[model samples]
Target chain A: MNRTTELHPFSVPRYPSGNPAQRVIVQVLVTQDAGQQRHAQLLARADTELRHLALPQYADEAALGEALATLLSEARVGVHLELHGDEAFIWSLCGVARAAGLLGDEITLQCNESGRRMLFCVHCASLQAGTCADLQPCRQCGVMLEVRRHFSERLGAYLGVCADADQPYAQARP
Target chain B: MSALDARVGETRLITPVIREVSLMPVNGTLPAFSAGSHVQLHLPNGKRNAYSLLSDPGDTSHYRIAVRQQAQSRGGSRYVHEQLQTGDQLKISSPANLFPLHSTARLHVLIAAGIGITPFLAYCTELLRRGAAFELHYAYRAGLSDAYVEVLREQLGEHLHLYESSARRLDLGQLLGHRPLGTHVYACGPQSLLDALREQSLALGWPAARVHWEAFAAPEPGVPFVVELARSGRQVAVGAEQSLLEALESAGVELPNLCRGGVCGQCRTPYLKGDVEHRDLFLAHEERASSLMPCVSRGCGSPILLDI
Candidate 1:
């Protein structure tokens, strides 16, 4: 016999009828090795890996879009992919229906490639149709690149995610 | 498992079956415990209740806990104080320490109000045995109605200050006036007293970190709010209508809570983000910025985030 427990009774409601389109913001952090002088090569390699995997296709857009009709259903989930390096890379992949541009929704990911451990957001979505240009500089600090490398050799790379456009990335709060 | 059993022993009536009931390990192997450690009592009815260990840690023959019958209690305390027998065998969890005595301090000031004296009594015994400098301020109603007065007086002697609040009030400011520097103040009492002590201690320049506290009972419930469990991604509605603990329990979050009254800090979780109207008697004033007791406190506004 199976004893199934209903963890939550309340469910997310779908968007109101005739409501406007919605958008979601995404962020990613990529770390690069200090020994490697060519940062662009590393980024290109990662972009290739992301395109090859195509998580958006794996998620089954039709089913996910149906689920997104629920009010509690989040449009995007944040993903973090960490690489071995002293410099940390951060990326944001915002998913917006072509009609809604950007709706101030954001997701964060923290990845540890060495430990093979990754943390992902449950309610958010990954980008379905967007190029690398859609991924701009850090939204919060306006840093030029996705990765922020510290001068010190000891400190490793880190990533952050946020929902508000004004405050895109926040440092981890204890 | 054996080690846990060895620590909790058998149940015995330290006073009488109806008034005061005590449980000790039958194996005579009570674990080495600190001043404010508590044990989980597995009653004959199969329900578990956490009780503060009230005896000297050095005494291995038995581990003692006192139970008072609450007329309206949800049966845990009522059963132990009313229905349980002197020699009844009870399955008990090993001793767990949350309200531990600070050993680093040179002087320890312990303040207990009403039944909150249980943990301090054990601390007194340990301090006396170790020749540690300590003072115990016990506040309770006057007359023969006060429990453990005789034993406390006999054991603590000059170190014990009995403030019968029924006749006079406990002047916290006056009592704490001469408190020496580096004296660690530990208090466990009613919410009003704890709140007053917390406010006055900070006003008087006592470092917020040095003051330690524990609550003996849950605070009165207040208005409820919606709580968003960050991990499960579920929004649980909680308020004065129901406790946060009950709300979470109903939502199917398995919180390892023993005393649902906020006395034990077992259910403590990090406040990822949100405003909480704290109703618990535990937690020093300064600590409130970082921690909260979900058992009694309710969210003040929408979507109080919790890292449970």
Candidate 2:
């Protein structure tokens, strides 16, 4: 498909001149349900602790981690958290939080696994594994999670590696 | 409505009831109707089924419709074709038209596949009555499967073009090229045929508003999303897997809906906020900004707040 023609309003643009190291910031707003309240509490607690943690300059790992913790903690109440950050950091933090038992069992993770790029559902607690399927409200709980991304100038460093991964495609003649 | 009452006021079996029977009735007292008009037949079991009127509008008392027995269908078509005799009565409603004739064009182009030919047959009838310029491209899997072929051939003569897809595929692009300027195109068929026609028309720069469609059945709904009733402050979670209308209906929200496939536009509601993933075939893209067909479209990532 032609990228230009298939472009939707939410699609990210190709940054030709931008630095590869920069990361994007995403904001996720999670609504709480009975099964998700615990996850929210965990996230709130992690956010409080991580806000004071010292991390690399231009890298908001501390904030990102806190967001993950908040999301994971809410998993128990069926509350889903949205995370916005560089793709890599979001995946890593989510993985860590899930491993830490902050994220619960009902939540399913769907991802490309190889590409590590896709949308995540807080309700299902699952990453979209391959192509995005139809948007669905959570069946287990009624809460909906909204995901939005904001590219921050300060978070640019973390994006450098992934941005370079696609460099070879730019060199190919169209 | 008596079980013995003929659904159609007038009846004429134009063709003998072969393996599959077809009927052309003279609809007495039935009001004049446009293309895509259908009449509801009340069955003995108290259920109703709608069949498109296929006869010419000029001929009063004669409304044409063809029926094929489906082994799995709820027995509407089978009863009409197999059980109901020519003189038998069927309880039918007055002619109602959800698919109206397009008035914005000098030339009308019609494409019909299989049983989809019913509406176009009526359209051609109206066009012939008005002496309007129009072209009909009818495609069928087999020449024998083309119901009413003899009638169309005798009536339309050179104006009708029939193609057998079993021999070759219908070339929509070629047909589009020969279409007259300011022509309005109407198509009905299986999703694949309709999809192909839509894609080719869009690629050829046909105005989105100029293309009309009516799907036989509503396609399955995509993933669900959350719907927040703004006035009632009732938040309901709907899966992309099921239609919001269906979900709401199951939840006991009484929303008026007809032809749930998105043609009637009766299920439209105000969108208070949030993104809507539109899938309905009724309104043009511009109409989507304010209202949505809750029957088909799903909400995007966020919770769609609706006035209803």
Indicate which candidate wins on TM-score.
1
Across B231-277, the per-residue lDDT of candidate 1 in tens digits comes to: 78888886454577766766777577666566666677777788888
The lDDT, on a scale of 0 to 1, for candidate 2 is 0.56
* Candidate 1 residue lDDT tens string, A15-54: 1111211211122222222313333443454222231112
Model 1: residue B176 alpha-carbon error in angstroms: 1.3
User: At residue A106, what lDDT does model 1 achieve?
Assistant: 22
How many clashing residue pairs appear in each of the predictions shown? Answer: 33, 47
lDDT of 2 by residue, A1-174 (tens): 223214442343232211211111111332111224433544464322211111232245556466556544443212222333333434454455445342222122222212333444433444432222222232333333232232222221111111122432224545
What lDDT does candidate 1 reach at residue B164? 86
lDDT of 2 by residue, B143-229 (tens): 344777777888888779888776767798887753433467788777898899778765554545557777764535466578888
lDDT of each: 0.55, 0.56
Chain A TM-score compared with the true chain A, each model in order: 0.15, 0.25
In model 1, which runs have C-alpha deviations exceeding 4 angstroms? A1-174, B1-19, B26-28, B44-47, B143-145, B219-254, B263-308
Report, to 2 decimal places, the DockQ of model 2: 0.01
| CA deviation > 4 Å runs, candidate 2 | A1-174, B1-28, B178-180, B218-262, B267-308
